[model samples]
Target: MKKENVVIITPCFNENTTVIAFLKQIEEVAGKLPFLFEVIVVDDCSSDQTLSMLQKFSFVSENITLTILPLRFNVGHQSAIYQGLLYAQHLDADKFIIMDSDGEDDPEAIAELVKFNDYDIVNVARGRRKESISFQISYYVYRFIFKIITGKILNFGNFCMIKKKVLETSCHTSFIHFAAHLSKQKVKSTSITFNRLKRIDGKSKMNLTSLVHHAFKSFVEYAEELLMVFLRIFILVILLFFGIIGVVLYKKLFTDEAILGWASTMTVNLFTAALVCVGFFVMGILLLNMISRRNQNKTEIFVKLAEKSELLNQN
Candidate 1:
């Protein structure tokens, strides 16, 4: 039998209703595609019947391989996809696709992505985002911060495809944001335009605090660069702190009408002291990131096998 390799990985969390809708669209898309398609669905220990429902969903087609990897516990969205990517590395796939099970990423676009085997990776950039005004604003701010720290403008999410060459290393990254790790791969990245779709089921698992945390994780990956940015800013602030002090001293020394009193001295002292405190705080954060990078275990991120080919037969 002639088989061409392509795999899709999706991280599922309480997506009981949405996964079924997602797979049905995949089935429709798979029928028209020209290669063998295998799907790796990582269940991040959903507290609902998402896993069980997926077990039932495994019987879409006998030809298509449906593997459900249920983690030992919930480890968040990116971790689930990371586990799936680690598993996909062993599949000897020609192409690997990452998308969401909440139906925000269109399954119909899979063929469009998988067609590009020229580059190591092809990311789908959203031409139209189906997000709220608040979310859009937050995402823009997040991207702006990302640009400052990493010197890269990342406009895509996990809706992308990578060849096997990129998968071997991209899967095992310590960075929580998989896209950030992929961005650092230095391989040629191709992009296509796609419109984002709304979720089919429950609300997003990420809140504002979670979004901030997610953005922070990316910065954590580029800790050295972030430390440099901090240092540069620190230098400017210190210079400004002393510049104000110099101005105060110049007025006290060189001017006749200068208000020379204890109030002025206390104010200058207060500003310099506040700057020092802020410097220590920023230094502490960078130090923590350095320590975290040193302690991160790339290979130890756990992935427990739930069911592989059994999903097809059991359903």
Candidate 2:
């Protein structure tokens, strides 16, 4: 059998204090696995000592094949991950794995991820959360709202593996939201149970406000679907508005009884107003999507944030 080139991609910002230990754990775990593997770390331009530290670690590490990719500027976590995937594509990697640099995703889980060769994507489901009760509550609230709005439950995070073909298709999406993108594929991927580990170093970069922003950000990936839902609603309301108007007209023109009360009159007016309002909002959203797509040439945006490999450890 051929030895497939497996890759692990991580996006880091100010993780210098903890990334070495994280990489060490990955090295130890990877040594026990049989396939050819490489660790790809994308450093989202950080203010701390993380860049230098990764350089130093790369200089000394001999057990693992590591590549330190530093971005030209900070593009946030999702973009960083996307750039890493693009580089993996350049390297012709067979299996691409993505995880958080904060060490919340256990390195040991990599073994379980690759075992299922049949899956195009392997998503990790959080079996136990290590966050505080408040955080958990907030997460549940976000998940509940996500399901209510998009009809898809948000359970997984960045901890997942994608085959090269899946990765190619996924990069075309607006954002690298693993759960939402994989859900869009509807490919029947497999998932494994894993606990969310507490951060090994600094506090989480995302606060409640950022978390809310993150939750809503998934919509960018589902723009078409969201537009369809809104269009359906708008159409339904317009149809109902006409139906009610027809009913009211029938009562006034075709009925033999006396004119009806104000209830039917008010319903027609309110529904007409609602239909117009919905039409305006839906058109605005579609216009926004068009402008967004024009502004967002993902390949161009990510390419501008180019990566340079520092030879600080692997072969």
* Deviation from native of the Cα of residue 162 in model 1, angstroms: 1.3
TM for every model, in the order presented, reads 0.83, 0.83
Residues 38-108 of candidate 1: C-alpha lDDT, one tens digit per residue: 88888887788887888776645655778878776788988788878777888867799999888888887
Q: How many residue pairs clash in each candidate?
A: 0, 2
Candidate 2 lDDT tens digits, 1-315: 766778899989888778888888887777777777889888887778887787777523343488777776788888798888777777757688899978889888998997878888888888897777887889899888777667886789889998888887766654545567677786758788899887877466667787777876676556666666766767777777777677778877989765558647767676876777687567758766784784366663332322343322221
For candidate 1, the lDDT comes to 0.77
lDDT of each: 0.77, 0.75
Off by over 4 Å in 1: 59-63, 244-296, 299-315
Name the best candidate (by lDDT): 1
Q: Return the lDDT, model 1, position 29.
A: 84
